[model samples]
Each structure stands twice: as structure tokens, then as C-alpha cells.
Target chain A: MENQKERTTIVLFSGELDKAIAAFIIANGAAAYDHEVTIFFTFWGLNTLRKDEAVNVKKGFLEKAFGWMMPRGPGKLGLSKMNFAGMGPQMIKHVMKKHNALSLPQLIELAQEQGVKLVACTMTMDLLGLQEEELIDDIEYAGVAAYLGDASQAKVNLFI
Target chain B: MENQKERTTIVLFSGELDKAIAAFIIANGAAAYDHEVTIFFTFWGLNTLRKDEAVNVKKGFLEKAFGWMMPRGPGKLGLSKMNFAGMGPQMIKHVMKKHNALSLPQLIELAQEQGVKLVACTMTMDLLGLQEEELIDDIEYAGVAAYLGDASQAKVNLFI
Candidate 1:
């Protein structure tokens, strides 16, 4: 018998790795329930979708001045905030390696394995001067209109 | 010289246990960082604040049609979603137990221990016909205006 599937869609608007991780966790959790899931990555969230650009953790005083103190790319995230303090970023790297939850890369791999749809926001790409070739191959391009269409039909719509 | 303190706040928007667990995780994570944290429960998220209500796990057709289920209260959630697969709720119950993650009750207890704020939504209470007496002892009442006023000054405002 064919099973009826429920759709879960989320519009993720984050450029930070930590924020991205939060969205991915929820997506993965919902997918585990066998729901058809779609994630629309807009604004900063689109950075993780870049194919050639490595997810770099931000660093240094200048970056920190601009609120870039968190790890440069998607490589550093997931330690509970309390655990993040005291331990240097290097230690975080080691722990993440041990736990296998290292940033967007692992999340991307997991999302692919779990069949979560990845959509990039064209508006963000244009604003960031990102070309279509810059995004990861697994990603599909969609404008806000397309994303809204998907979101309208979803049983659950989340903005994170 | 006295230093400025970093503020912490967690906003929980979902009535479900898994969503509630995410809030607990973030709340505890903040508390671990020695930041003053607050958890604002609003709308459907009020399910966690209901002292008499237990966690609702979706059992297949039998439980859905009938009311037979496990985990007497919110404290019992995450059990089925964690490990149970074959024996119905039993598999879920086992998986959650393996992780030692906080159940709703335990999470509430931990919030108490950590001095995490548990703010109940005033409007939701009136809408749902919930009285103050129906809630747990640690709850406080705040309107949406109050929550947003505080959230504006907060470094992080999460809707979980």
C-alpha cells in the first residue's frame, strides 16, 4: 500500500554555522519521522550551499568587530554554548571530530543521506554576487515565490 | 571594575516534547555559560507548563482511535521518539532512556536548579482557559509585549 506523506517545510535565513546547525537538526529530526521535508536557505543560510567556497569559520579582531567572532565557517559549531566557553576553537574542532558533528560539512552529508531537500534563494545569491556555479551541486535554485509556494502546502512551516 | 553581564534567553513555541527538549538543551547550555536565562512559554508551547498534562506520543491507529498510551505526563515524552520502533511506544521509550536526555519533568526540574526563568504567556492562558492555579509553581505571567520588550535587548531571541 502507498503511504500518505506529510510535508514539513522550513525557511532558513541564517549565515552563521550555529544557526544553520539548528535548522538542520530540526530538519533531520522531522525527516526521521518519514515526513517529506524541504529547507529553503536564504540570505546568509545560502553560504553553506556554496560549492567551491569552503565554509570558513570567521576569526580575528576585524571580523569580530563586525560580529564575526564565531568560527569562520561551518566547521565549528554544536558544542553546547557553555561548553564553548573556556575551550579554545581548536578544542572544539577536536571534540567535533570525535563526535562526528563537525559543522555544515557533516550536516550536508547527513542531509543528503536523509533526503532533505536543499533550496537556495536566488535573491541572496544576487545580493552576495554569487553565481549559480558557486553553489554546491546538491542545491536547487528558487526565488522567494517558489519557496512560498512550497511553504504554503506544508503542514509545518518554520522560520529559523 | 565590574563587567557587564551577558544575558541569555530561550523562547519555546512548540507544545511537543521533542521541541521542548531542544529548549531544555539550549536553556541548560546557556545556564552552563553562567548567563541569566529565561524561557518564555506561549501559545501551544503551554503544554509543557501544564502540571496535570503528560507528554503525548502518537501511537499508531490503535492509540489514535482509543486513548491507551504510556508516559503519564510531559515528563514521559521523548521516550517513544528516542528508541521505540516495533513494540510501539516501548521502542521509543527505550531509546529516550538510553540517552539520559531530560524528560519534560526533568527539564523543568533542571530549569529550577539552574535558575532558568519559566515565563507563561498571559494571553494564551486566557485563550486556553487555563488558570494560574493549573500551572506549575515556578511559572510567571507575562504578556507578548513584555516578552518582546525584553527580547529586543537580548543578544539572542529564539522561537523553539
Candidate 2:
């Protein structure tokens, strides 16, 4: 029983601002409860791990276009709903500040501090042409099999 | 030991056609593995359970507007990406038919036949003004707490 810690895994598949926030909030909450948590970022969810600055990495035209089109990082993601252009993210950020809730970046920091494992899906990175240098540091890189391994054993797994 | 069924739970939170198909595919896959699967539909996911035809339920102006704006059922939902107005869903349906893949409605039907528990979020119903008559039959109406109870015991829980 000592080695059997509670485990939780989350697959963040959406790039929307609200969904990412919800994913992190739940991850942080689970980590606080002493569960071993992992957030597997795939598809558009990879945008959450990207650096805000443009990285000078040579890529094929389609890959470059994908990288250009996806959001740079947590700050630039748009809302899944009510995104009146870029205003929805601004309003949500404003409200979050007003309510003293931790920002997305801050939530990531907290999750890292809480020892929640952050894994970026390597297959998605390859397909989208995202380089490790273009993403934030301290996160591990892996494939879907690794995620399934963690998920099959976890009592609370979520695809966000 | 015979009574201890492997449990899995999925929270379908997106209303898009592709996302719904993915949710059901996974749910069906798990159920095929003999896992007791529960798919808790919340927010826009409830649209998947809506009847193809509108029910003549009296509702407030906001509720009526919401009902009008949201998709009526699986056939009416849009794709999350590459949704060129309404053409994307049509193209996906065509491809699905050609590939002999189960359509979204058929997937839901298979889920029911596999004894997968299809649950609609009751709190969301109150907020969205969706009445029981508006949804398809045989689904249990529940809230988040009920979902949590199931999720806590399940080896896999996903919020899609």
C-alpha cells in the first residue's frame, strides 16, 4: 500500500483558453491531494507548452505554417466560446485577476512545484513541427504509448 | 471477483461532431474490452443526446435562443476543425460512410447496446433549459456529484 499512490492523468487535447485553464486547475487540485498527476499535451494542446517568442528553427513550409498559426503560449490562446475576436481572453484574464485566481503560467509553475509530471506528446510535436527548443523547458517528451501506460493504471484520467 | 468489473468514465463536454465521434469510439472500445463504461454528457455535449426534432417545451427567451443556436442532435453538430461553415460535417459524413465507419448516431446506439451508461448532466439541463422530452430516451439524468462518485472508483475517467 505504501507504493500504491493515487494516480491521475489528463490529456489536454483542446487549445482553447478555458479548457486549458480547467485542465490545469484540476491538475493542480489533484496534485495538492498528494496524487501522482500527469498532463499529456497533444494536438492543439501543445500550444500551451510553446514559448512566446519565435524560435529560429528551420522547418518545412507546412510545419512552419502550423507553428505560425497556433498560439505562441498560454497568453495567446483564444477562448473556445464567446471569443469575440481576441476580447474574450482579455475579459477572462481580467476577471481571473479580479478574483485573485492564479494565471495559467502561474498554475504551470504551481503544478511543477507540486511535482505533477508534464509530458508533451512527441508524435504531435513531430506532426506539427514543434521543436523542443520552441517549447518551455523542464517538461518531458513522450509518445501516446507512455500516456496509455500511465492512464491504464490511473483511477482518475481525463481528456480535456 | 466476477462482480468487480473494470470501470471507465468519460465526460463529453464538447458539441463538435469529430469530438463526439472520438468520445464514442473510445467509449465503445472500452466497453468492447468488457469495461463498465459511463459517459457523462455535460455542457454542449448534451446536444449529442438531443432528439432530432424539436420538442414543444415552453422555455424562457434565453433558453429558446440557446436551443435554437445549439445543434439539435448528432446529425446537426459541426466539426471542431476544418469546419468550412457546414461543409466539413458533410465531408466527414461522406468519408465515414465510404470507410464503413459507424456514424455518430450508430456509435451512440452501439454504446447503449453494450450497456454503457449514458448520463446527461442535470445541472447543465437547468442552465440550458433542456427538458427531458428534448433528449433521447434511456439516458440517466444526473449532476456532477453523481459523476464524481462514479469517477472516483473508475480506473479511467476522461473529460472530453
Candidate 3:
């Protein structure tokens, strides 16, 4: 069981706010069990780990133009087929709040505390006009090939 | 631009109430613009589409046993980081509500009215002991192969 725990890691691919949150959720859960966690933030997922910038930034027209159409904030993400008009986001936020789940800011803290490896996609940074200085401190830069190399060894690899 | 609209399709992946609301917000927006729409549900996502299930169900040990380690409702989901101690789910809910996003219930109605394709995961059904009868009548069942087969051709595919 100890070996299994150590061996288990979740490789996350995220460029969106909600997906980033989802990766953190799983990372926090795994860390709660004392598992080694590594999150490879590629493409848009790098936004959260960006340094000196707000974690959640509004998507630009270029992003929208490329068919990346999701909203900027967690509250703006669409649910799977069960939205109550525009009310699904509120209900999720409300229910999560009632249940004492961690907010976005706290998740970041927990991830850091839990020793989650936050990796940023270097290629994405180059394409998006981001620099290493722009990402949050402690972020590692690697190519997708490197991410896949790490992910291939992980027991749990999630493309969030 | 017109071609882009036809290529755009919203896929709802969260079965949770709040996430579902988020999904609807995008769906409604897409529909209002007359964009092609398709929603795919998997895992817990299938719950929202359950035909006769109540919006509120008691969470048992099974939920903990299952993958749901967090609050089972929208309010408990912790929008940013799953940090609920210093923060409150109600506060999150309030912020989302103030934003005029869809409630869990409202999104479902909008999906139906807007003619979104509701696809549920068969694999999740087997794992959760859910049957087609347990789901809302509007859902269609598809295995991963089937869902991917359809999604492969989609210009836009969202995980929600």
C-alpha cells in the first residue's frame, strides 16, 4: 500500500480555470492520502501557475477564435446537461460552499503545502507570449514530450 | 465565422448541480447564437440526467467510498481550491447567485428546450450501479468508444 501510494501520481492537462480546479481537487485528495502528486500544466493550464498575474484571466478573442470557448471564471463553466438555465454555476458554488469545500485560493495553498509538483508547459508559454518570470514561483518548465515521459509512469493520468 | 458557429458544440461533463448550471450558461449562450450543440455525460455526470432522481439526495458512506470525497452538492465543491474552513460554501453560492448564472434545476430545463444532445456514459453506470431507468429520460447512453467516435469529429469538445 505504501509503495502504491508513492507510485500513484495524477498527470493533469489543463488550460482552463475549472479544469485547473479539478486537477487541484484530485491532487488535494491524493495528497490527503500522502501520495506523490505531479501536475503538468500544459497549454492553458499554465494560466493558474503564472506568476505576477491573476490566476483567472478573461479569455481573449484569439483564444475564443481558436475554439476555446469556455468562460474565464469557475462560476462561468457549463455543467454536463443539467444546467438550470444560467443557474447551474450558482447552485454548484452554493452547494460546495455549504459543504465546506475549499475555495480556489485555498486549493492553491493546499497544493503547495502538500508538495504538489506544478509544471508549466514551456511551449505554451512561448506561443502565448508568457515568460518564465510570468509564472508563479516554483513552477517547473518542460515540453509535452517531457510531460508525457513523466505521465507515462504515473498510475493515474488525467487530461483535465 | 458562420462555419465556426456550426463547428462549435458544448459538451457537459459535470453531473453536479452547480457545474451543470455553468454548462447551461454556455449552452444557452451557444443556443441563443444558434450554434450546434451536443452534451456528453460520464461518471457522476450521469446523475443529473436521471429521470426520477431528486435534486437532493442524502450522501452516505458510499459517496466517500466512491470517488466523491468532497461535498456531494454544488455548494460544497469549493470553486477555486476546495478550501472551505476559512471560507464558506454559502459565500461562494452567494457570489455565483449574484452573477445570475443558472441554478442546477434551471440548466436542465434549458438543455431540453434548447435541443442539446444528452449522452451518458455506460461505464459509469456499471460502476455506480445505475441503470438507464435511474437516469432522467432525456439522456442517451454511449460507451467511451461511441462518445469518442462522435466527439472525434466535433470542432469543439468541452470537458465541463
Candidate 4:
């Protein structure tokens, strides 16, 4: 096994704050264990990679509505549970900070620092009418085939 | 590497319908690939294992309130998103049926039939005021140590 390279692939399918945090935590943990970690963000998960500032891009009505209704970035994501009209996430974040836990953005930065590869799904971007400029810098872009190529070789593949 | 055992451990931490479906889907997929898969249900995830029938168990005010607020079993669990005051889950279920996808209960049965080990977290059971008789039969029960023991040797470890 010493000659074998360990790899972990995570298909991040959820854009909720807690789920995104879990994905990054797992990716960072795998990287710490000396495994090559790749996270493929698709559909709603792409919101995590979106830039906080709204980009000036032209789009159809529905696409623009989606862009407006959905969370713009990690900071704007709502909690999967107890989201009492958007107040639950803020309360949770406060509790997390009180306990000295890393914020979701901090976790993303840490994962990147630990060499965890972040890949945005190009198909999802197209469907959502998201331009590359609307996303954060320092990330890769690919489709599902590229993700499956990595997943096929990974000993651990998760759809989160 | 050829001689190594392929083990996958999943920590089911959320009780939401969508998350539970994802867990079973992943568990079944791993089993299809001949991996030894274990799903440890903890905290809210234990709600998935609850029987649809309400058990006659006495509890304190807070515990009774907790039980009342949370969904009783997999059949009653809500979706993680688009839950429009409970209508969204039914809508999603209808769509899944239309697409010939298995319901959450069917997925659970399939996963078990495929030899996925379903383990209930004993600590969570105690914390949530749940009893052994309230859950489905033929599943294992243990603490975090047992889960960590499996996760340590497993090639894939996920907290869903």
C-alpha cells in the first residue's frame, strides 16, 4: 500500500452553509491524511464559489431571478435546519464564533491552503447563467465527466 | 493494495429526507462495488430509524416537546430545501415516483438488502429519549468509539 496513492473525491451537491462546511472539513481532513482530495461543486453547490459582489451580467428574466433569489456566496447561504426566516443561520454563526470555531469561509481558505482542489461544474454555471467573473478566483472549472474521471480512481467518493 | 479490504463508513448526522436519501444512495453504490459499508445514525439521523407507529413511552416536558416537533420516522421526515411549510417534500416525492426513483423507505430496504450495516448511535438515542423498541429491528447499536474504530480503518469516511 505504500506504493499506492490515496485519493478522495467529494461531489458537493448541496449549497447550504452547514453542508458546505462539512464538505470542506472532510476535504481538509483527507488532505491532512495524505490523500489527494478533489471537490466538485455542482448546481446549488456552485453558490459557495460565487463572489459576494453581484457581477453585472445580462441574463433572461428567470436566470436573473434565480441569481437574485439564491444565495450569492458562502456568507449568504442559509442553514439547512432551524432557518427561522433567515435568523437561524446568523444565530448559528454567532454560536460557532463564540466557540472559536472556523467560519465557512475560513474553512474554504484552509482547504485551499492544504492543497484541496476545488472544481466548479461548468454545466451548472451555464444552467445558472453564471459567468466565470461572478465566481471567486483560484479555482478550476470542469464538467461531470472530469469529476467522474477522478471519482473512478478514488478510494473514497462522496456525494454531499 | 489488492489485498486490502475496502471499507466505507458514513456518519448520518442529519434527519432530513434529502440527506437520508443521499446516504442510502451512497451506501448502496458502495455495496454494489463490494465495499464493506457502514452507516452510523446519530442525533437527528436516528429519526430515520424510528418506526412510523408512535410508541407509548413516557417522557419529561422538554423531551415530549422535542419528540412532537421532530418527525417521527422516515416517512414523515421533511426535505432539506424548498420545504414550503411541508408541501415541498410531498411534491418532491411525487416527482421521484414519476421518475421511477425509489422512495426513502424503499432505498433503506435496498441498502440493508445489499448488506450495508445500519448502526444506531447509542448516545444519541439516550440523548433524544428514544428506546430500542422505537427503531427498526436488525440494526446494530454502539457509541462514537465503535464508529471511530470502523472509520479509522475504512478507506472512505463520510459525515452526511
Candidate 5:
């Protein structure tokens, strides 16, 4: 039993930089511990997977407004607290750099390099009018069923 | 092996109402599924465990200031997003009530009633100058080791 590999599934629900950092930190830790890890990106979480550059996608007015209002990518995400009208995230980034900690993009890269499965939710994409081209390459696209399938077999599951 | 009881551990690290609701919802779901569940409240998360009424406890100026700056209890906690000077939480609560969803305090009560083990981080308590008497009764007090003990065996572990 001790030799059996563990499995972890995380449902990334929040798009805030701090929460994304926590998710990646846990995912990295689980991967380091020899666990199979999967992160399901849904709703705002999918924003973290978006590329820094905007993708030209046709959309209705509301959809376009959503695209405009929400952060385009991980770098634009605001902090969950002390956001003083957008200054907090920059301050946190500076702190992270000062401490030589990995940035969100770097953490995402590390997670991918460690073979962590990243799944973008199809339902949310449709609702938010996000296109696949807007996100980074090499990620699986699935619905909640895919997430549940992984979660059912997981020894560790988290919704963050 | 199939008959062995599965365990779930949640590290409730945020005190915001939205996050707290999510944690309780997940905790309740796990408990309903017959998983042995534990929620380790640390740092800001301890604010959720605080009683609404102020306790007659003495403290230093900094300690009192800390208490004053933070939400007194779950009832006073703000939302993580769209918190337009505290109106967002009230609006969300209204919507929750309209949808017949459990309120945050009710969810906490339900989680407790469902046999979820609530563990308060002692180190964070000392750091924040929180006293046991100020929190809701019938909770375990421990440090990181206790949380790790639970997490080490948990079939589902979450940092929320």
C-alpha cells in the first residue's frame, strides 16, 4: 500500500493572484511528493491560463465587456486583499522577486514541466466567451465530468 | 481496502466570506459522503471562528488594534471580490437567502453538527493575540503538526 502512488485533483475556482499562487504551490508540492496531480480551471480560474497578449475573438457586447473588465491574464490579476486600486499586486510581485520566489508564470511553467495536467473547463469558456487561442498552448479542455473522474480516484482533492 | 474510511482535510487559510462559504460547502459535502473531515483554521481563517460578541479579554495596544482592524467574527467578514465598501457581502447574502442557500454562519454550524473536526492554529492565535474564549466553543487547538498529521492521511486535502 505504501508503494502505491497517490493522486491529487484541484479545482481552481478563483482568479486572484494570491489564490493562484496557493494552487500552484500545492500542485508543485504534490508533484514533488510523487503524486499524480491535475488542476481543473473553471470560471475565473481560466483567466490565469490566458496568454498575456489579447486574442482577436468575435463576441457580443456583454461578452466583449466581460473580456475588457476581467483581467486578461495571470499578470493582470489583482490581489484578494489590500488591492488599493491595483497597487497591491505590484507590491506583492516585488516582494516575491525580493524573496527569489517563483512568479505565477514561472510556477505555471514548473507545474507543466512536472507533468501536472491542466484542464480548462469548456462550459466556462462558452459562458465567458473565451477562446482556446486566448489561453496558453498544451492544455486539455474538458467539462465537470472530467474533473469528477480525476477527483474520484484522487487521494487528495482541493477546490480553491 | 474498499471499506476503509477515507479522510479529508481542509486548510481554511482565508477569512473572507466568499472563501469561508466555499470551505464550509466542501467540508459539508465531504462529511455527507462519509469522509472523516477536518478543517484547520489558521491566520485570517481564525476570524471565522470568532464569536460575534466581543469577549472581555485584556490585551496590549497592538493586540487590540489587530482585533479592531479585523472583522470581529464571521458576521463581519467582507467579501473577497466586488466588495464595494462592504455592500457586496450584504448583496451576496441576500442572493444566498433568495436561493435558499445556507448562510455562512449556518454553514459553519452545519459543518460542526456534521462532525467536522475544527482545529484552530495555536501559533496563529498567539500571533494575532486571539484567545480561546473569544472563539466558538468545542474546537481543538493545535499547531502545524496537527494539521500535517491529518493531511498526511487525508484522501482529500485542500488549502482554501
Candidate 6:
């Protein structure tokens, strides 16, 4: 029989642009190394998977407040440090473009094309009052148990 | 031969109080499960290992600025969210005390008592101009290669 592919998992727990980019870059690199990679987005990390445009979804007051308050999608995320009222992300994007490095959105697409599994944490979605329609297409929804199962089996598991 | 202990590693990359607490909680839990746990402190996360009082180590102007600017230790870190000019940490500390949860310092002591390996990233120390004298005792200093080696061998590797 053929050998099984090595597995890697990342729990994306931060919502900032720089952290998300770091998480995706690592995930893509692991996928390139032929690992069966899974990026499980939870808590504020779920913001990375949101669609850019506003989604028409009915929600309670708190949920609506969350929707309005949180950044809509990857393009809207701020840098974790040196944000300087959102200018840090712009500088980072410019530097990435100049260096010929893939932007975070492009890196994410590359991950998807590389068959890296993207799983959104359902429990966090519930907590953040986010709906499936509000997220990008072609991702799976799961909870902590699923993540724990994957992480327990994978040698490279990161909570980013 | 006896079974090998399950290995786990965590890269503490955030310096905030809440993140440090979370990292220690997970590390402590994994250790309790009989895993050989290692927490490699890097970047801002190295602040978690610092001594509260100022150190007499000589440094350049830039390094001195970094040392002066960054939080002194676990007790000085701010919350990641809702910092409210440092009030957030105080509130959290009060609540943790009320709940009888171990404070961050207590958690670090417990980690030490449990023989959990605490490694400070030497590369980060150099970058931030932190001398060995500035950090707490009973911990190690290593670079990224050492961390990658541990991560590759461990089943659970988290970057927090």
C-alpha cells in the first residue's frame, strides 16, 4: 500500500490582517510540502472567511451589532501591531506587492487550489452571529471536537 | 520498551495577558495529560518570561527604548481587547482571583513545578535587545531551528 500523507492543522484564532496572512502563508507552505492541511477558523479568526459585501441576513440586536462592528472580510482586516489607525496593513500590502509575494487573498486562493481544507468553526459563527451566506463559498463548517480530532492526529497543529 | 510520551509544543508569540494565560492554560493541560510539553517564547511573547523589576544590563539606545517601552512582565501585560487604558487587566485579574483561577505568575510557577520546558527564543531576544539577565531563571534559550525540530517531532504544535 502507498504511504499516507502527513497531516497539518492550524487553528486561526486572531482577526488581524498580519496574523491571518501569517497563518495562510504557513498553511500554504505546508500544503506545498505535501501535507494534508486544514485551517480551522474560530473566534475572531472567522472574520477572515467573510465575504466582502454585506449579506442580507436577519439577526438579533447583538448579532447585528457584531456584524456592523466587525470587519466585513479579509480586505478589511487591520494589522495586529503598529496599526496606526489602519495604515500598517496598507504598508504591508504595498511591501508584499513590491516584493512579488502573494497578497493574503491570493495566498488563500492558492491554498484552496492546493486542496488545503478550510473549515469554519460553527460555534464561533453562532457566537459572532455570522451566517453561512455571509461567508465565502466552498468552505466546511465544524466545531471544536472536529478540530480536536484533527489536531490530535496531526503532528503539526498550530493555534494562531 | 515503554511507550514514548506524547510531545506537544506551543510558540507563544503574543505578549498580551489574555493570550499568555491561554497559552499557559493549554500548555498546563497538555502536561497534565502526560505530554512532554514545551513552550517556545518568541517576539512579543518573550515578555511573559521577563522579570518584573528593571535589570542593570547595559544596552544601546534602541534596545533601551525597547526595554523601557515593553511591559516588564506577566503582571504588566494588557488585555488584547477592551484594554480601556489598562483597566481591563485589573478587572480580569480580580475576576480570576474571585474564581480561584491561578494568576499568570502562579501559572508560570505551576508550569515550572510540572517540569514543563520553557524556552525563550534567543533570536527574538537579540532582536528586542533583551539580555538573559532580564528574563526569569530556570528557562532555556534557543533559536527557530530548535523550535522547528521540536515542532516536527511533536503531535501538537500551537502558535499563540
Q: Give lDDT per model, in order.
A: 0.61, 0.88, 0.57, 0.84, 0.86, 0.87
Error of 6 at A106 (Å): 13
Off by over 4 Å in 2: A2-5, A11-17, A20-78, A86-153, B1-3
Residue A70, model 6, lDDT: 95
Error of 2 at B139 (Å): 0.7
**Per-residue alpha-carbon lDDT of model 3 for A1-160, expressed as tens digits?**
3355442344454544345555676677666656567887666566566443234445566743432343333334444323456564454455446556676657877888888887777777656655565456766788778777765555445556
TM-score per candidate: 0.44, 0.63, 0.45, 0.66, 0.66, 0.63
Tens-digit per-residue lDDT, B87-149, candidate 3: 654665667679986566566677778877777766455444455654566667875545444
Worst 10 residues of 3 chain A by lDDT: A66-75
Question: Residue A139 in model 5: shift from native, Å?
Answer: 12
* CA-RMSD of model 5: 6.0
Model 4 chain B scores worst on lDDT over the 10 consecutive residues at B91-100
DockQ of 4: 0.11
- Model 2 TM-score, all chains together: 0.63
lDDT of 4 by residue, B1-160 (tens): 6787577788999988877876786677778777788999999999999999988887888777777877888989986666778886776576567557788999899988998999999998878778888899889999999999988878667788
Which has the higher lDDT value, candidate number 1 or candidate number 6?
A: 6
Interface RMSD of each: 16.4, 4.7, 10.7, 5.4, 4.8, 4.7
Across B1-160, the per-residue lDDT of candidate 1 in tens digits comes to 1374444466776665555755675576666666567889877677677666533543456433322232223644441111233342343233345545345577678888988888999887666555666568866899888787766555545676
Writing each residue's lDDT as its tens digit, candidate 1 over A46-148 gives: 6567554444443443322222222323553333344455454456556667887645577777887899999987744543445666567777888655654
Instruction: Rank the candidate models, highest DockQ first.
Output: 6, 2, 5, 4, 3, 1
Best model per lDDT: 2
lDDT, candidate 1, at A13: 57
DockQ of each: 0.02, 0.27, 0.04, 0.11, 0.20, 0.27
lDDT of 5 by residue, A1-160 (tens): 6776788989998989999999999999999998999999876788999999978988876467657767988899988789888999999999999999999999999999999999998866765678899999999999765665577578678787
Q: What is the TM-score of chain B alone in each candidate?
A: 0.74, 0.97, 0.66, 0.94, 0.97, 0.98
